[model samples]
Target: MAGFDIGEKWPFALAAILMGATFFIHLVAGGRQAVRPLLADSGTVPLDARMTLYYAWHVVSIWLAFATLIFFLAAFRPEFEAIAWANGVMAAAFGILAVVVTVLKRLPAAMLPQWVLFLPVAGLAIWGAIR
Candidate 1:
């Protein structure tokens, strides 16, 4: 990885921050500022099984965002090519997690998670961009 740019992966962290900020903005604009509903449940599905699946999705996304943070570090910190390897693995992990959650809960592969989940995803994406 000679000649690899340290700045290549920077800006991820900024993307993450923007994501979290966007959620707050949307929540305030929508006039639904309750923490419990935003965080715990959204009342979208009726079945307990569905709810569990839904929550599982949220949990995975949360973790993915955290992993994305690590990748972002590579960009900002400019580690060796090993950072690329770590980020690549994280990317695969996110994909697998997303697919598994979608299939287990009978959710469409392209489906969007509830608002709560968006915040973290946005945060991760933004963080990636800024880092």
Candidate 2:
């Protein structure tokens, strides 16, 4: 918030880019290794790009999104003047698109954490609208 303009093009875009980069990294990293925290022991099957793509792009994209929320809350919280209809549109778009696509696809329930479906993208939307 000190030097950032949350509602402005530069700071918001920078944050979004950082979020995107984080998502991409998680996708390529095959969150399986990353997800090991939840597993009982090591030894897991190798996954191809498709696996990487889903976990990384599909899953990590949603998971790391919280960072984007936090970044905005910390960086752009001061920019209330910037929070407007455009930001609202972005929030709705992102939250809806991701959740809708995943649900409509009927993605296999087994491959994901049970609560993964309930992640609060609405929080991101709220953060976006606030900033």
Candidate 3:
């Protein structure tokens, strides 16, 4: 029960909450707005490409859920701290990639605001890992 001290591990808990929320938002809103529309474009998009993108979207959903679980466990289990660190690094990478791609495409920040959702999760998880 060494790391079961919830009061001292609030950052990991908060990161878990944020990541869970992001997962749900991605599952519900992103599915409705982006996934469905992309799939619906059968006339313009090729079958192989559409299916590939759909598969990738599901992969993200799975990763988010897995990260949420890992961070949540890290809040109570000290051994999972390393996994949390890895997740934080990946989250930071995702955030940076989103920003770079948005800028490269000359799109408005609002159009690709994934960094907003990702960076805080990275920060919190990393903070928890060090503390």
Measured by lDDT, the strongest candidate is 3
lDDT of 3 by residue, 66-111 (tens): 9999999989988898999899999999999999999999999998
Candidate lDDT scores, in order, read: 0.49, 0.47, 0.92
TM-score of candidate 3 versus the correct structure, residues matched by position: 0.95
Q: Can you give the TM-score per candidate against the true fold?
A: 0.35, 0.31, 0.95
Residue 106's C-alpha lDDT in candidate 1?
A: 94
Give the per-residue lDDT of model 2 (tens digit) for 18-120: 5556556555554565554423333454455435634654554674565555545544555442442244344455556656666778876433332232233
- Clash number for candidate 1: 18
Best candidate, TM-score = 3
- Model 2 lDDT, residue 103, Cα: 77
Predicted candidate 1 versus true structure: per-residue lDDT over 6-87, tens digit per residue: 4555444444344445434534542343334534554664568555655765564465455445544555554523543444
What's the distance in Å from true for residue 79, model 3?
Answer: 1.2
For residue 85, what is the lDDT in candidate 1?
Answer: 46
Model 3 ranges with Cα > 4 A deviation: none
Q: Candidate 2, after superposition: displacement of residue 42 in Å? A: 33
